[model samples]
Every structure is written in structure tokens, then in C-alpha cells.
Target: MAKELEGKVAVVTGAASGIGLASTGALLAAGARVVLVDRDDAALAAICSERGDAAIPLVIDLLDPKACATLAPRVLEMAGQIDILHANAGSYVGGDLVDADTAAIDRMLNLNVNVVMKNVHDVLPHMIGRQTGDIIVTSSLAAHFPTPWEPVYASSKWAINCFVQTVRRQVFKHGIRVGSVSPGPVISALLADWPEEKLREAKESGSLIEASEVAEVMMFMLTRQRGMTIRDVVMMPTNFDL
Candidate 1:
């Protein structure tokens, strides 16, 4: 039997590790040709080596907003057309805003917020013209609830949540699906900066989810029947308190 995503082309950012890497695997497993974009050239090459020609690696810094402008065209040149875009690249700063370094905050926002908007903008025209595409963002539970521990991180996610919803409306008529998956405390590098005590506690209590679990949710969003968009998925470990 032909795979559901056979012949589809997907672009996944931050594709070298964690949720991004997991999502890339899921997309490939479902039979989509994948273009892996990341700033880590070595890691990108490593993943491509494992996946072979099915995974095309593009190493570029998403923090450079200019890269977003060139990304779609680059992908088109390499793959001809884009059918799915997983704008999952992001950075996290875990701390009270008062304690956060000004430059660090700017860097986080640049990657988390600005890059997301520009990536979506760059990919939209292709999907709109073809009248079909799926865009899934790796959002966070922090977006839905106020997070005292990381105010800046939470606010960035909230901005993306709103953008996904608004953009979903803007392109629904054109056969595009726009949504976000907000997972709580996933065991990824993003959690590396978490208060060590909190991180340890979550791990001990099984309150932290694996990156692959979130990837499964992303695939679920894309595999739905046409016209039925899985708007948002808020996932967390069963033992998680918040």
C-alpha cells in the first residue's frame, strides 16, 4: 500500500536534534521526502548520513532573518515544491525576566518569534498557489498558561499561538492547515537550562515527555482527513502538575 505521505515534500527547521529531529523522522517514516534545515552543520550531516537521500540537509542560521527570505526558494530549487513546513526551530531562556540578560532575551525572541513569522510568510505563497499545505509549529504549554519561571519564553510562545490561529483563518480557504503543538516539559535541550531541581523532579516523576512523543502528535495533525484541521494539541506527561 502506498504511504499516506508518499510523494509529499516537507521542510523541517532545527532538524538536527530533539523534537525537530524526531519530527523529521516521523515525516520520513510516513513517506514524505524531507528537507532538514539547521544551524548545526555537523549534526545535520550526521542525521543525513543515517537517513540517506531521503533527508536533505540545509545548514543555515535561522536567527538571520535574511535566511528566511531565501529558504523557500532554496528548498524549491532543491525539491521543486514544498508540501509541509514544520517551523520548529527555537531557543529557550529559563529565568525571571528581571534576571534575564538583555541580549540573551533578544536572541531568544529573534529565533522563537521573528523566525517563525518569516518562515511562515516565506512558505505561504507556495501553499497558496498550490492550494494545499500543512504548517505545524512546535509551540509550548507556556503559551497557554503564565509561567513565572520563564516569563520571556512563555510570552514568545503566546505570540506564536496567536499567529497560528490568525494565520489558520487567513489561509483555510486556500487548502492550507496551520496549527501548533504545545508540549509541556519535553526532554530536549530546551530543558537543559531549566532549574535543575525542577528538571530532576520532572524526570524522577515521569513528568517529562520524550521528543518522539511530541513528534507523533505532529504526524497526527498532518494525517487527518482533508478539511479537518487539528487546530492545536496541548500535550503533557500524565504526572505533570501543570
Candidate 2:
């Protein structure tokens, strides 16, 4: 039986762990060859090895604007063409904005906001030429509402929410579909510092989801029929509050 994404080529950033890793696995299972991009070379190599030939590992620090510019072309040169660009690379700093470390804030914005824009800018032209592509961003529920404890993180997602909508409009005529999956709390490294008590409460309350669950939603967004576009999917645990 042929898979839905058979013969497709995808580039997934932040692919070494968590949702990114899970999404890559989903894409591969659907028969797409994937270029897995991450900052950790060793981990990326290990996973790519485990996944075999379908996964191509690229170690990159998304914070470098120049790298973003060159990434798509590099992937194209290697993979021939890219059918999907999963801009899933992002960071989070959880704390009151005033009390947050300025350095952490800068890092989060640089990766979560700036890198996403740069990657999109670089990949859009190729998709335009092909006149078909799918760009899925990993956003967060915080984009929809204020997150007092992580103002900067929320603001970054809010920015990308607008970006996805605006870019979807810009390239829709050319057969490019742009959208985001905004998940609430998920079991990932992003929550590693979430005050143990809070994490415990969320988990115990069934308010946290697994990374693989979000990965499946990403697949749904990608596998939609050509005429259909899934703009945004906000996935939160059923018992989640707010």
C-alpha cells in the first residue's frame, strides 16, 4: 500500500528531540524522505542512524540568520527538492518578563521568531517555483491568550501566529499552504524547568499531552487534500484549563 506522503521530501528543524523528533518519525512513516535539522550534532546523528536512510541529519544553530538563508538551498541541492518545510525550531523561557533573564529572552526571540521568518523567506521561492508546498510551524496555545508566567514566550508565538496567517494569504495562489499547530502543555524538554510542582500538577490533572500526539496533528495538516487548507490547529489536553 502506498503511503500518503510517498516520494515527498521534507525539512524538519529541531528534529533531534520532542515534538520535532516525533513529527519526523510520523513523516518518515508516511514514506517521506526527511532532512532532520538540529543544533545537537551527536543526537541528530544517533536518531538519523536509528531511523536509517529516510532521515538525513543536519546540525545547525538556527540563531544564525545566514544559516537559515542557506539551509533550503542546501537541502534542495542534496534532496533535489523540498515539498514540505516544518519550521518547528523554537525555544522558551518561562518566567515573569521583568524577572526573566535578558539573555534567555533574546535567545528565545532569536530562535522562535527570527529564525522562523528567515527559514520561511528562504524556502518560499522554491515552493513558489514548484507552485506547491506545505509549511507547518510548531506554535503554542500561548499564542491565543496571555501567559503571565512566560510573557516573552507567548509574545513570540503570537508573532508567528500572525506570520502563518499572513504568509498563507501571500502564497496561497501559488499552491503553498502555510499553517501552525498550537499545542498547549506537552511532555517535552521545553517544560524541564516548569517548577516541579506545576509540572506535577499538570501531569496529574491530565492537562499535559505527549509529543507524539502533537506529531499526529502535524501529519493531519500535511495530508489534507490539495484544495483543503488547515490553517491552525490548537490542541490542548481535554482537561486543560484555559
Candidate 3:
């Protein structure tokens, strides 16, 4: 049986771990050749080795704006063309805003917000020329609600939500689909900032969800019919409150 994404190419950032890794797996299973981009060279190599030719690894730190701006061209060089882009690279800054380190805030915003924007911007010309593409960003449930504990992280996602919607409108005429997936309290490295007790409490309460679940939602967004755009998907554990 033929898969839905056969012959298409996808570029996934932060592909060595967490949601990016899970999403890469999903895209590969659906028959898309995936370019795995991450700073972790060893992990990327391991994934490529396991997944074979379909997994192309690219090591680049998105924190450097210059490197980020070059991503689409590099992927095009490696893959010939990009049919999909999952801008999933991001960092987390939790806790009260006043207690957050200014430097840490800067880094998180750069990765979560700036990198996403730059990557999509770089890929637009290509997708526009082709008149077809799918761009899905990994946002957070916090983007839709005011989460007091992680104001900085939530704020970054809120910005992404707006960006995705605005960019979707601008590019729909070109046959490019843009959207975001917002998952709450996903089980990933981003949770490292949470207090041990809070993490345990969420887990015990069934308030945490796996990264694979979020990837599932991403696949749904990517696989939608061209006529309809799933602009945003907010997924959370059924037991999660607010």
C-alpha cells in the first residue's frame, strides 16, 4: 500500500529528541524523506543510521541567526526540494517572570520565536514558487491561556500562534498551508524546569502527555486536505485542568 506522503520531503528541526524525534518517525512512516536538523550530531547520526536513507541528518545550532537563515537553502541543497517543514526546535523558560534570568529569557525567545520565524521566512520563496507546502509549528497550550507559572514560555507560544495565523493568510493564495500544534505539559526535556514534585504530581494526575501524542496531532495537521487548514490544535491530557 502506498503511504500518504510518498515521495515528499520534510525538514524537522530539533529532530534528535522529544517531539521532533517523534514527528520525524511519523513522517518517515508516512513515506516522506526527512532531513533531521539538530545541534546534537551523535543523536542525529544514530537516527539516520537506524532509519536509513530516508533520514538525512543536518547539524546546525539554530541559536545562531546566520545559520538559521540558511536552513531552507541547505535543506533544498540536500533534499532537492522541501515539501514540508516542522519548525519544532524550541527551549523553555518557566517560573515567575521576575525571577527568570535575562540571558535565559533571551535564549529561549530566540529559539522559540525568532528561529521559527526565520526558518519559515527562508522556506517561503521555495514553497511559493512550487505553489505547495505544509508548514507546522510546535506551539504550546500556554499560548491559548495565561499560564502564570511559565509566563515567558507561554508568551513565546502566544507569539507563534499569531505568527502562524497571519502567515497562513498571507500564503494561502500560494498553495502553502501553515498551522501550529499546541500541546500542554508534554513529557520531554522541556519539563526539566519543573520542580520534581510538580512533575510527579502532573504525572500522577494524568496531566502529562507523551511527545508522540503531539506528533500524532502534527500528522493530522500535515495530512489535511488542501482546501482546509487546521490553523491550531490545542491538545492536552484529558485530566489536565486549565
lDDT string for model 1 (61-177, tens) is: 888767667899999999999999999999999887788999999999999999999999999999999999999999999999999999999999999999999999999999999
Stretches of model 3 off by over 4 angstroms after superposition: none
In candidate 3, list every pair of residues with a backbone clash: none
- Write down the worst ten-residue block by lDDT for model 3: 1-10
lDDT of candidate 3 over 164-207, digit per residue (tens): 98999999999999989999899999999998999999999999
- Superposed Cα deviation of residue 11, candidate 2 (Å): 0.5
The 0-to-1 C-alpha lDDT of every candidate, in the order given, reads 0.93, 0.91, 0.93
Q: How many Å off is the CA of 75 in candidate 3?
A: 0.7
RMSD of 2: 1.1
Give the runs in model 2 whose Cα sits over 4 Å from its true position. Answer: none
Model 1 CA deviation exceeding 4 Å by range:
none
Quote the positional error of residue 181 for candidate 1 in Å: 0.2
